[model samples]
Each structure stands twice: as C-alpha cells, then as structure tokens.
Target: MTAFAEERRADRAADAEQRRIDAAAVDARRIEREKAADERASRLNEQRQTDRVRAREAQARTRAERRAARGEALTPGNVYRKGTLALVTASALGSLPAQVLHFVGISPMLLPLPLAIEGAAWVMAAGVAYADERHLPGWVRWFLRLLVLAAAGFAASINYTYGLHLPGLSAPDRQAAGIGLAAVTLLGPVLFEIRQWVTTLSADTNSPEERARRRHERKRRRQHRSIAQLADRFVSAAPFGQLDFEEAFAHAWEIETGTSTPGMTPRLHQRAARSTAALAQAQRSAVGDSTGRGLFGRLFRRQTESSPIQNPNQDESPQSITNRLGSDLQESAPETPPAGTEPPTPESADPAPAVAPEPVAGPVAEVEPVKSAEPPVLRPVAAVESGPRRATGRVPQSARTPRPTRTPDELLTEARSATADWPDEKLTAEAIRKAVRTSSANGRLLRDALKAERAERAVSEAQAA
Candidate 1:
C-alpha cells in the first residue's frame, strides 16, 4: 500500500509537470505571433507615412513651378529684353555686308555700302524706349525701317560721289559734314519715335481710363447702329402715313437704349425715304390752290403747272364781275378757222352725234356699262343612271371571309385579261396603264406590275411573231 501510494503520487506529479511545459510552449508561440503582428503594423504605418510625404512634396513642387511660370508671364521687362535682343541681332545681320567689305581691302566710300546698320540700331533702341513709354504703332515700326533704308542709300550715294572731300572744304570741315549726316540719319528715327510717344501721351496718358472710355464709346456706337437699322426697317415696311416718323424713331431709340430721347437720330437713308413719302403726300393735298402759298404749295404748283408764269394775261385794272362778260368778249372777237378743218355753218341745224369717248388708262377713269344683246337662260341637268339599282354587286357584304380588294397584281391581271382579245395597238402598255389607272390602288405598284406584264408579253410576242 505504501509503494502503490508513492507510485500514484509520482504519476500525478509527472502529469502536472508535462502540462506546465506544454503551457510554456503555447505562451512562447503567442508572444512570437504578437511580435510579428506589431512588425507588420509598423511596416504598413511607415509605407503610409512615406506616401504622404511624397504626395506633399509633389504638390509643393507643382505649386512652385506654377508660381514661377506666373511670375515670368507677368513681368514686362522680359518682353522688352527679348525685343531688344531681336533688334540687336537684326542690326548685326544688316551690318554684316559692310563688316565683310571692311575685312577685305574694299573701301566703304568706293561702293554703295549699307551705313543704315547704325541708324537701324539707334531706331530699334528708340522704338524699344517708345514701346516702354507707350504702345508703338505698327506703321511707326514700318516707317522706321523705311527711314533706315533711305538713310543707308543716301549715305552710300554721297560717299561714292563726293568721296568725303568737298571743294573748298578742309579735312575737319569734311569730317563735320560726315558727322552731321550721320547725326541726321540716326536722330531722325529717334526724334520721330519721341514725337509719336509724346502724341500718344498727350492723347491718352492714363491707360485704364482710356480703355474704359473707348469701350463705352464702342458700346454706344453699336447701340446707335442697332437703333438706326431698326428705324430704317420701320420706315421701309410702313411708310410715314401708317407710322409717325417721330414716334417710330423714338420707339427704336427706346428699344435699344431704354429711353425715348428725341433728335434727328435716324440714319440718312431712313430720313430720306420718310421725307420723300411726306413730300409726296403734301403735294397731293395741295393741288389747285394758288392762295395757299407755302413751301409745300410751291413744290406742288411747280410740278403741276405747265406754264412758267402764273398769269400771263392779268391786266392792271380789275375786270367787271359779270357771268357773261367772258362770253360777250368772245362774241365781239372775229372768228378764225384752222387751215385743215372747215368752219361750222349756221344753216346746218342738226348737230353731229357726240362720238363715244375712249376710256382713259388710269384707276380713276370712268367705266362704260356693257350692254348685252339677250338675257341669260337657266337649264336643268339630267341625272346620270348607272347599270344596277341594287346597293351591292359581285361581292356580298355579309360573308365569312372579307372581299379581296383590288391590288396592283390583281389590277394588272384584270387589265391584261380585259385587253387580251384586243388588237396589238389596243394591247399596248399605255392602254394597260390607262385601264389599270381606273383602280384606286398605288400608282407605283400598278406601274411595276404593268412593267412585268409588258416584259413577259414582249418576250412571248417576239417568239410568236
């Protein structure tokens, strides 16, 4: 019993010892797993932080590049420097011919040398200065170029012809003349540029103010054009009679500018057309009135009167007021007959029948009544009777199947069957077309079927004939 008890105690002790070792192994494995998880989390965090740093750096770099580009664009001095460089390059190229000549043993005085290089350089400098002061006109630049060419040509001609030695002139005097000529050529373009700059400055010293004023002026001009064009259309569509000239022009101006400002604001063409129509109406109303003496009356009378003088036979003394006064004067005067026509005799009492007057060619002329020889009669028309009195024929209305209406194929078949026994002249395509045209089917379908039938018949007739 003591040995058994000791063995049992040892077995229990070994089992507990084994359980502790297994628990220690499991705790170590769990520690290792926790460390690996922490390492992975740190690595992910490091990657995310690096990505954020790279993104921020990239954004900063982009912003710096854009800021630099903006700075370059806004600076005007850069443009001026570039223009100066270009002018210097052009000047150098222009001076190359003279430079080459001098490099060789050729004297500039012997040939037509291009001395314009110095003048061009000076002009370019002056132009750049003018551009800095105020915008330069394109024509000014072209004029400067032309001046350079002329100066060079004139200098070359003078050098070649006079050889810098005038009669009765010493070396110093000749040198002074040459210096004066060079000064004239160089200072001419510079002085012109300065004058242009002064003019520009005087005209518009403040740029923003001038720009605003010009923009406002342009807008006003456009408004005026629109108003004038509208007034012209109104004057053309409806004359001054339907539309009052003043009211129409005021309406047009109000439509464009929102104000009924009255003035002679209409265009020339519109004004002229309105005036012509008013003048015509005035002349029509002022006819045959000598007492109404005014501008309108005079215009009307001058157009209507054939005689130059108003009253050629007006006597100084006033005539007696009598109804027969003119008739008595005419009876007292002797009668005179024309050479071609005979005078009327008193013995012939019967007056000739008055000849019917011909109609005048105008809207206001009188129209003669047309006389008819006989009265018009009314007649009744006979009713047309067709073959059958029955309501329906051939196909009945109440049938199981609906009646097949005439189609193009059926129409052509019926037409050919009807004309089958006719002569060749009656059996033509035209006859077939006429026979089929009586049906209310599609004309195109009818024509297509006719074409097929015609082609078949043609082939059969060719074989038969």
Candidate 2:
C-alpha cells in the first residue's frame, strides 16, 4: 500500500509537470503572436509616415510650380502676355456691355447683333495671327487687317452714338462720354492687334542663325533652279505630308544625278574609281613588288655588270644559286702541274707583271671536269602563278554545301512561316539572312516583302476597326 501511494504521488507529479509545460508553450505562442502584431503595427506606422512625407513633398513641389507659373518669374514673356490679356479683358468687359445695352434698347432680338459685331472683330484679329503662323501672303494679312479695323470702327461708331443719346448726360458731357466710349470700344481689338504685332516682331521669333539658314536655302534654290523645280514636282506628286520639303529635295537630287546617293553621279563614281585605281597602280609600280616593275631591274643590272657573273644556265632558284657557287669553286680551284711534271721554282718562273684575271677566270691549260657515269639531274624552276587566291575565313566553292535557289514567293512564304511570332524590328536583313541562311540580297528582298505584308495587314485591321 505504501508502494502504491508512492506511484500515485509520482503520477500526480508527472501530470503537474505536463500541465506546466503546456502552459509554458501557450505563453510562448502568445508572446510570439504579440511580437508579430507589434511588428505589423510598427510597419504600418512607418508606411503611413512615409506616405505622408511623400504627399507633403509632392504638395510642396506642386505649390512651388503653381507659384512660379502664376508669377511668371521663370518666363518674362508670360508677364507681357498675361498683362495684355488682362487689359484686353477689362476693355472688352467695359465696351461690350454698353454695346449690348444700346442694341438691346432697340430690340431684344437684336441683342445678338452686338455680340456678332464684337465676334467679327475678334475673328479678324485671330485671322491675322493664323496668317502669320501659316506664312500666308502679305495681301492675305493686309486684307484681314482691313476687316479687323472696319469691324472695330463700326462698333466704335455704335458705342459713340449710344453714349451721345444717353438719358442722364448733358450735351458737352454726352460728347465727352461718346468719345470715351468710342475710344474704349476700339481700344480692345487694337490692343490685341498690337500684342500680335509685338509677338511677331520679337527677336526671339527668328534668331540670326535661323535667318542665315533661310538665306542659304534661298541661295541654294536659286543656284540649282532645275533641281528646285524637280523638288517641287516631287513634293506635288507624293501623298500630302508623307514627305517633307528636304526629303523631297533629296529625292530630286538623286534623280537628277542618276545615282542612289544624292549629289553623286555614275559618271563621277567611274571617274573617281579610275583615279584611285590609277594611283594604286602607280604606287605598286614604284615599289619593287613581286609582280615585277620597279627600280629593281635597273639596280640589279648595274650590280651584275660590276660583280662577277653567274652561269647563263642559272634560273631564279636556290638550286641555281648553289650550282653557280659550285661552278665558281671549280673554276677558282688551284691548278696543279700534270702528275709527272715537276713544279716550277721561282727561278724558272716567268718574270711577267702580275695580271688581273679575265671576265671568265681560267687556267691556260684546261683540265677536264670529273664526269659522272649517270646524266645530271635537271630540276625545273618553281613557277609562281598569279591567280585569284582562295579567301581565308571562307569555304571553298567545291567544299561548300550547294543550296538550291529559291524563288521570291517560295522564300517569302518560308520566311513568313519561320518568323511568324518574331517582331518587326527583328526581321532585319542580317537577322533574316542568318535565320533563313540565304544570300544578303535575298534577305533584303524577304525583309521588304514581309514589311509590306505586315503593313498591308495593319492597314486592313485598321480599316476593319
């Protein structure tokens, strides 16, 4: 019973220990969750702070831009433009109401009459600006200017008459009021016209360099009158706005020169080719090249004349030189008396003066050369043929794989299939050449065909849309 009691105590202790462990695990998990939540809350605060700071910065930048734009400190021209706009606005507001009232007194339906008159004046003023921007004829500008003055004059007269007939004014006061009304009524469009003139006359409209360019262009047109006419013709023939004046002029130059490149001609190209080739040939001839013309012949001839000569049988070869050296050795070999004859002493030697050797050095008595039983071998001279050399980094024609020639339609069909998913820019001449393994010319042809096909497809799609 004591043993059973001890086991019961131990079981209780074990259960207590397990409970404590579970409590500790729960606490640890709770702590971890709290830590994660704290981290998330901290991150949220940081993100909110960052966004607030960014918004403040953006607002500050916008405010600064607004300030600069309203003040026009960054652009002085804006000051003039905005000031003119204000003056014109004030003038129009002062004049337009009087005209409207004067006309409205006549008829309610005639209210639009004053507005039309005022609109006509503004429209003519705007027409002057449009004419200037379009580089229209001076006559067109003058005509528009005359219309602006006429509209303004008509409005001013109406304003003056309305002021004169006002109910509250005396005679002299009416005249003054009439003059003032007429002056203010005319001043609005006149001020706008003046502003337009000032903008046109501003030096910034055309720089000195820009003026020089125009002068140069005009001079060139005068110099090349025919080319200019051709350029005009080309401009007229092309679709509107498809080609600019300069590009059309370039095409004209190409046509006139009979070449693909503008300002160059086939005749000039041939002449240049001849000149360069002649210079290269002259340079080659001046130098002692293997192809053989130069001072080499003259120099070598003089040397041969001064120096001991070689055998006539010698050709231009290493063996020929060796054979010549051998023959020389034999000729220069010390002569010996006949086998039976005694050698001559100084006493019996002839006292003749020492003499120089002849052109062909030899002994008075000839000794036979040692003959061989077999005939001498004759080696042929090495001949260097000047034919076209096989190009390095290229396969020989015989070694290359023979590719069957493909027609444009067949090749284009194949290319289209091969490159269906490829982008337009990737379908260049070189890329097509590598991908299709075709000639450069054929690659270009295929590229053009594919481009045309894609363009047509795009056009059709757009039309369908």
TM-score of each: 0.25, 0.41
In the predicted model 1, the residue pairs found to clash are: none
**Candidate 2 global Cα RMSD:** 22.0
- State in Å the error of residue 269, model 2: 31
TM-score: model 2 vs. ground truth: 0.41
lDDT of each: 0.49, 0.69
Q: What C-alpha lDDT does candidate 1 achieve relative to the native structure?
A: 0.49
- lDDT of each residue in 293-365, candidate 2, tens digit only: 2332333344346554532212224443334432232323124433554444446543433443333222223
C-alpha lDDT of residue 365 in model 1:
20
The number of the candidate with the highest lDDT is 2
Residue range with the least summed lDDT across 10 consecutive positions in model 1: 391-400
lDDT of 1 by residue, 317-388 (tens): 122213322222221111232344444443432343345323221222222222322221212222233232
